[model samples]
Target chain A: MRPAKTMKIELKVNGKRERREVPPSRTLLELVREDLGLTGTKAYCHSGICGACTVLLDGAAVSSCSLLAAQADGAEVTTIEGLAADGALHPIQQAFIDHFGFQCGYCTPGMVLLTKALLDEVPEPTREDIVRYMGGNICRCTGYAGILASVEAAAKALSTKD
Target chain B: MRPFEYVRPTTVGEATDFLREHGDDALVVAGGTAAVVMMTLGVLRPDYVVDVGFIPELGPELDGSRSGGAGLRLGALTTVRSIERDPAIAGAYGLLADAASQVANVRVRNRATVGGSVCYGEPQTDLPPALIAMGASATIAASTGVRTVPLAGFFEGPYETVLQAGELLTEITVPLPEPGTFGCHAKFTVGSPENKPVANASVLVRTDEAGRCVEARIVMGAVGPVPVVAEAAAALLAGEVPDAKLIAEVAARAADATDPQDDLRGPVWYKRRIAAVLVERALSCALRKAGNGTR
Candidate 1:
């Protein structure tokens, strides 16, 4: 067997620029959770099926578990941990808390990040849009009523702030 | 996932050369949505992963113009989400757009590429039947240069293609439908929004000024080793004004052409039945779009 080769990748995580040398087999989920020690992004199905590993890569939501760490080189990555500003929670984060969008909290981070990406693209997404956009993220605890309500509330909150 | 060496070649030529040298030990990865997942599942164990995700030639942006009867050329790296959002594609090839939009979910669509999906050669996927119905073709690059293969004859079997070692799919060109032609795609999933279709159908119909069917193409997917073209069903509508009885006949003919396998989706008989239903609905939808009343 050949020795594993590593590549040094520079990524803009949250608001900071960080670099790491990782093997090619390392997924973005592993890089974020293990190397960067940012465990906010949860990994359930290592495959792309479950959205529990969703994160924003260059402002678009993608399954980090399916994304190679090397592919994310020089890209801007945003996780659930990045939603807070200074000491206050972002509107979407606060909306999730107020709406009780999570129960076991396993799928919360991915759900929250997916909501952020959706609202970023469509500020006033309709119910159909919410269902379609958030369809990938599976929340086993809160069913999905609270998650849908939280997304709607976040949209309203963001619009009112503008 | 097993450890593998990674190489990011700058150009298509360089990539193809590297792949040729590595032989079957190397696998080219674009979006990594399929490749990485297969790797994690131990389904594929390659010694080297050629990361072509960043090559400018294979990005999500569609290149080339659709001027003077020219067809739309989509780079192989074009993301499914990008295809879903492109107004030009939606306006001209609505079936392709709808098919792309229906693939998995937003996150997967955001990462999965049109070329990757096609090259993955999964018969159950939503795009192949729609693409085959649209008369699309793919340009592949290899050490020996390039070749374009029609989407109709691209697949050899399930999860397999005619793609030789060191060959990489670079672009997919879809010819513009002829005047008075309308197309529609429909898929029937079990329950979840993200579930793959148990059976899918794509229909393209063109009606003459007298409201008679001039041309018809019916393609059925997810029920066979490849996207099955129901030529006999298409023949039923070739020169006739489609009606309820004729449409039912065509649907049955299409279902008869299916050679399905029993899997977690359903039994072979159930899948064939769903295929017939989808074909009928897709044909009716396309006929309506073509300004023909299937009464």
Candidate 2:
């Protein structure tokens, strides 16, 4: 097989504008992990599921594995590392800590980012809305109840703040 | 992932030139949902990958009306999530949205292109069968030029499409159903939150001025090598009311229409049975929606 060709993209990653020359076949998951050195995004299945690699592409949560690094061109990407205030944690991150949302914490980044996206979209989403929107993120830790509670808690916090 | 030469063509013509120069050794990466993941898994390794994701021509173009029989014109690069949120699509072609929204997850939907799904034509894909029900068409372009192929005619066989070596799927045109029409999509995937549907079905129904059944179509996906039309189910609605018994019979015909095989998802028989049940349930839901409208 031949070596994959590379393409360059101008991405605003973690609030810093950087240029990345990525393989045409390189996934967004790889871009965030390898080139940018932002390993907070983890992909368990490396497919669409397992939510281990979920990140906000253009402010919408999506599976990074399914996207080519070249596709992130001219877009804003916010990974787990980008979700804080100065050095402080984002509220969603705090909700996870407060609700004890992690067991092994392997899926925490993906779940936290995915939840952050949902709460961003619907600050007062109902339980069913939460389930449908958050169904893609899988937690093998069997810590779903805690994750759901954390999202709900974050939602409550956001509503009160609003 | 095996190393391969990646080429980013600035325009569709440049992309086509790359394909024409590379042939089977080349592959077009639209949304990169299937190709990117497969390449990463070593399931596929093509030489000279062409990046078409940035081609402005292939994006979601929503005109306020999915009515007037002129539905939304979806570029091949239109992400599944685009369908999920577009009110025109959700309001007019909601079934497509239902299928599109549920594809993989929001993450994959953000990058998975509509044309990519139809062009890939994987038997396990979720779009073809739904398009079959909606009377959608695929606009395929090649060196000789483009032609509009009805969604049913595009799927040649397993993992193949009528798309030529140099041809790229440019658009997916979802023809709006008539006013006072109802449509629904169902799939038997093992991962849905409500119930893991192993079989997927799309049903569309239109009633006449006198409140008689005028037209209907139910398409089944993931059951066979290609999206098969549920002719028996469609025929049953010629002049009959979409009652429970009739809907059940139509759904049964839809199930029997397919010769599904065993795979990781489920057994062949199981898929067939769900196809029917989902078809019935979907049509019933469509009927209810139709009743609620100002028909």
Candidate 3:
């Protein structure tokens, strides 16, 4: 059997454009963590069942672990590393801190990213919206009460932003 | 996952050609939600992945477009979230929207395409039975030409469909329900909110002016190799007013039609029981929506 050829592809990651030659089997999670050195995006379950590897692709939240890097070619991807700007934590991040949204912090990155996507789509989400949008991203610690509160607080903070 | 070659076909013709050339060695990936997961789990190993996700025809946002007198046409690439959030779908085809909403979570729904879900042919999925109950048909295109397969008969078995080697599912057209029709989909999930259904049922009911049952479609999913249509159950509701006793009978018939197998979700008998319960609940919900309460 012959070795598979690597393909060169470009991606817009966290406002930065990156070009890399990767094997087809390299997943978006691997691309972010390994190639891009953005380790904030955690990979708990390599399969799609867990939302620990969630990222925003073109503004839609998707499981990065289940998305091949080749499929994300020429696409804009936003990981947890992308949320902070100019040494300032994003409002969602601040809200998570204030509410103590996470205990172990393993699922924090994915949760925060998913919250960013949800807030972008629905700036003023209701409790139900928060639950539904954040349903995929599981947090074993805190039992989700703090996470839900953080999302609600973030939505309020975002709505008040000038 | 084993390394493979990726090919993004710009056109359906090109995609079909690749599929034909590679045959079993190639797999077509749309959203990559299911395909990527399966591949990473070593369940599927295709040497070549034909990605049609970038095809313009498949990427355009779905719009409300009725075909002649044939109801709404949903392009194959329509995302599950798109269907779940579409107001037109929510208002008219609530069963479909409900089913779409219940699939996995928002993230998966954002990436999983409707065509991918249907083509995956997983018996436990929510769309098959809901679409089958809605009298939906799929338009399949290939190197030869195009043909439509009724969604009810589209499935051959678990993870199997009537789609040929080189055929691509282009669109799924759901006919306008009869003027008096109302439907609902009920799914019973045992574990988390994102867990696959142990048993699901979709019921479409059409009542006459006098509130008598005129037509009905009862479909049970996740209990068999394919979405099982309770033909006998549906027949029992035709031409008569539905009562609690009749609904129970129909539900029993639907349960009897199931060929459930013991799996991680539940035992066969448990799923059979859930199927009966879901059928009754779905039928009652549909009736309530139709403004006809069971007597």
Candidate 4:
């Protein structure tokens, strides 16, 4: 009915294709942070409700904790590590830094990426829309005003960049 | 989480074969939002997880160019966010797009597929009522091959589906109502300042050239094991402009007919009261849009 434990998984992480044997019981979050040693994608709740474990699976945001490492075969994954290019932060990441969008910086990675995605799609999202889209991303520090401001500013920056 | 073998079958046939063999001990995970959460909580202990995410046959099916009498034929894998952005879908099925736009959050919506939401078969889920109001149907595939089930007859009970052990949902087709028709969905979620509908109401109302009510479909979500259709409510509003008297009468019938359980959102009495308020507002919204379309 099921394999014993370990399973072979192939994935493209951070622009590099990798093949590794991982435990069937291990989550994608564990494999990302422990086995592959890419810790930029933070693991907070280890549950689907928190957005701290968010990662881009084929350009879509998904909680890594909720996925099995063995299920990632032949799939392309991009963590926070993959966002910046050539040592320069992506615009959204840069916007967070400029706007001081974080206090403890635990939720910043996921929030920044989520904001980048929403602004990429919505462009001129209203304040209500921004809040609604970011509902699942919990920010315990900084009270979310700066976070919202950063996203709005980033949206303006992104629109001008285009 | 229980230790399990996670298999990714690239094709539908392969998935079907795997499900047929391992149906009893296996769980088919598409988005993994629910399954993984359940596994971590030890709520589910399936030994084998057959992932349906990578199957090409179940990808988002959107019509890019506007075609006549055309609506969306959404593949089971189409994410809620993807549905929200599709131009033709927004133009034709605004109520669905509205519902999709408001589901979960950017993180969850990106991973939550339309098929997954419908297949959830949860009585309180937000999609079934909207789909029923829009006349949506799904193509389910089993060992016997493909068959279409109207969104009406799909759900059997809470967390229960008419889907057989090895059956797979392939597609969901939502018919676009007549151009002049209007649809609205209002949900009520507690402790949310955003005025997000707590006990959502999804309604479809239309009018003829003379402003007479042509047809109507009013469905309430989050109140029953399945989205409840208001047949009597529809009959009362048919062939009539939705006036205050009609709205009051429909509201009264809804309060009497609906069997909503008391839960966190509100007590049964509160829900009954909100349903009356919501149904009237929903009716006005639909009628306003129909009037606007005729203008």
Candidate 5:
């Protein structure tokens, strides 16, 4: 058998440049929650089926648990912990708070980040667009009504702020 | 996941060279959606995992101009989301776009690639049937040379492909639809559209000036070990202007072509029934598109 190998990867995480030597099996989710101490990115289903591990990679949402940290060698990753700027919660986070987009908070981080990705791409997304784009991030709590309202509120808040 | 050696190759030639030396114990991964999941699940524990995501030539690109004869050339790394949204593909191969749009959710589509999806050879996928119906072919690269194989013959069985250990799929070429050609892809999932289909069907039909069906190809997926090309069903539609009755007959024939194994999604009988229903719906849709030229 070949010897174990580790890869040296340098990537921008939450606007801060960080470098790490990650094993081949070290997933982006592990790098975020374990190594970087950013627990905001949750790991639910280690598989890609659940969106609990969603994060923004180069402004697009992906399941962090579904990819290797080495694969994200030179990319920008935004976890839920990175949403606040200068102690002010991002508008998407505020909307979730106002609309109660989550319950139990297990799926909240992913939901909020995914909403950010959506609003960034489509500033004023229609209801159908919201439903379609956010379909992957599943929330077991609130049966999605609150989540839907939260996404709409976020889109409106961002558009108005723009 | 087990500890393993990680290798990232920047070129296809380099990738194939490494694979030729370590192919027995190495696994090539692009997109990492399927591979990482399998590794996490302990279904695959390779001593070496080759990351092909960085290879510049195996791009995340969709070039319609280079596809000779009005077809489309899709890089192995082209994300499914791109295929779903690209205006050129949407205009010329709407059925392909429709199939791509229904793959998982935006997140998975954003990460999964057309080549990876096809190469994975998982029977219950959305892209293969549409590609097969469209007469697409795959371009594979190896240390020896390169070869193009029809997508219809790319798979061996469930989660099995004809890709050799030292080989990699570079691109897929979707041929131009003959004039007067229209196609439709229909999938029936047990739950949300994001779920893998219990059964799916893709139908492409061409109509002559006299409105007679000159050619047809129907491919059914998820109901067999590999996607089934329903030649008998296509034969029935030949030389006839497809009607509701004739389409129903073709649907039955297509369903008869399936060799579905019972699983959680559906039983053998249920899959066959869904296959027939999807074929009927898809054929009806394609014929409607042909009549109106709305495709």
Candidate 6:
């Protein structure tokens, strides 16, 4: 039998520093959900076609399922669990509830994280911008109308709060 | 997925040396977007995954030292998202930027590297056709020495590149189009915008002050095993005033150059027809973009 190889990686997950010894094949999704117990990041299409495993890697939205934990070493990772502050729902998360952003809620984490990334980049995005930027995060339910409204509401809410 | 040992080298030289020692057993990954997916699907089972993402020299940089000559140097690790958003690149190579923005989606673009995209040798991609049309060249690093290859001749076949074992694609240099030169990329997707293109065309046309075609380069993607250059189509446009009739003929010739395969995107015949229409659209768009500054 061949001996399995493991590599030690250190990364900042959700503003908390984390260190782990993971195998080369261990994906960032696996590390976050299994090892770190952060299951908020879902894994859907591991081939990167679907955005169910989206997360913020150094503030940019990326598919965590297609990324290796070892590859993210020394980088900062922001999962869905990182969004809120001190027992409060993030404005983006609340906006989803206010606007029915999801139905089954399977793709909410990715959609919310991607929304965070889009809003951070484009503070005041037009409807067209919202549609284009959020095209990657697919939701089989809610038909995306609610998601679009949620994103628009989130943008407005975030701006007003600021 | 098969288990493998991961090795991260902080320098290109160190990465090449490790690759040389391991030979085919080592697979070099830049962004790990494609590699990780392949690894998970059991399509790639390398014994050693040599990650070059840690190599600072290969990281993102937009060196315009050749700005005097209107050339640009892009490091291997330049993400597709950066190419789409970088003002400098967007200003000089808008066609490349537009094509980069069309790749997969925001999440994939955030992680996929330009070098990784080219090295992956996927025919149904966007960047290669535009890069080929822009007359790009790849700088490859090896333990033996360094070499440069024109981007047009880089691909050997589907999922294959001319890069030998232990070699690394370190940089891509694009010679900016001359004045009065305009380019456009037209892609036909099956349904969704993020889906792989069924047939795509990139046309770069340079016209003289009198509106006579001085040079033209037409490249087709997703309709061939590799990015296919429509030499005959380009030759037809050379020294001619591009009228609708001439453009139509050129587009037909461009379609003739394609060798598409039946895939989930579309069948071969449909791809050929779509390729022709896309070529026509791209050529017309490029001609219209000349001195107009509207794409």
What docking grade does candidate 3 earn? medium
- Give the per-residue lDDT digits (tens) of candidate 3, residues A1-162: 122368788999999999999988899999999988999989887767679999999999999988889889999999998889999999999999999999999999989999999988998898999998898888888899999999999999989994
Candidate 3 wrongly placed segments (more than 4 Å): A1-4, B66-69, B292-295
Error in Å for residue B136 of model 2 = 1.2
In model 6, pairs of residues that clash are none
Native A-B contact fraction in model 3:
0.64
Q: After superposition, how far is residue A151 of candidate 2 from its true place, in Å?
A: 0.8
RMSD score of candidate 2 (Å): 2.6
- Tell me which residue pairs clash in candidate 5: none
Show the colliding residue pairs in model 4.
B186-B200, B187-B197, B187-B198, B187-B200, B188-B197, B188-B198, B188-B199, B189-B198
| Candidate 6: segments with Cα more than 4 A from true spot | A1-4, B63-70
Q: Assign candidate 6 its CAPRI class.
A: medium
What TM-score, over all chains together, does every model reach?
0.96, 0.93, 0.95, 0.90, 0.96, 0.96
Model 5, B42-102: lDDT tens digits are 9999988988899889877766565557588888999999988888888668889878888
Q: Interface root mean square deviation for model 1, in Å?
A: 3.4
Clashing pairs in 1: none
Report the C-alpha lDDT of model 2 over B269-295, residue by residue, as the tens digit: 888887888888888877777777631
CA lDDT scores, all candidates in order? 0.89, 0.78, 0.87, 0.78, 0.89, 0.89
User: Candidate 4 versus the native: TM-score?
Assistant: 0.90
Point out where model 1 deviates above 4 Å: A1-4, B63-68, B292-295
Candidate 4 lDDT, B155-242, residue by residue in tens? 8777888888888888888876786778776666675322234466777787888879989888887666677788798789878877
Alpha carbon deviation, residue B294, candidate 3 (Å): 18
Off by over 4 Å in 4: A1-5, A85-89, A159-162, B64-71, B192-198
Estimate candidate 6's alpha-carbon lDDT, on a 0 to 1 scale: 0.89
What DockQ does model 3 achieve? 0.53
Q: What is the C-alpha RMSD, rounded to one decimal, of candidate 1?
A: 2.4
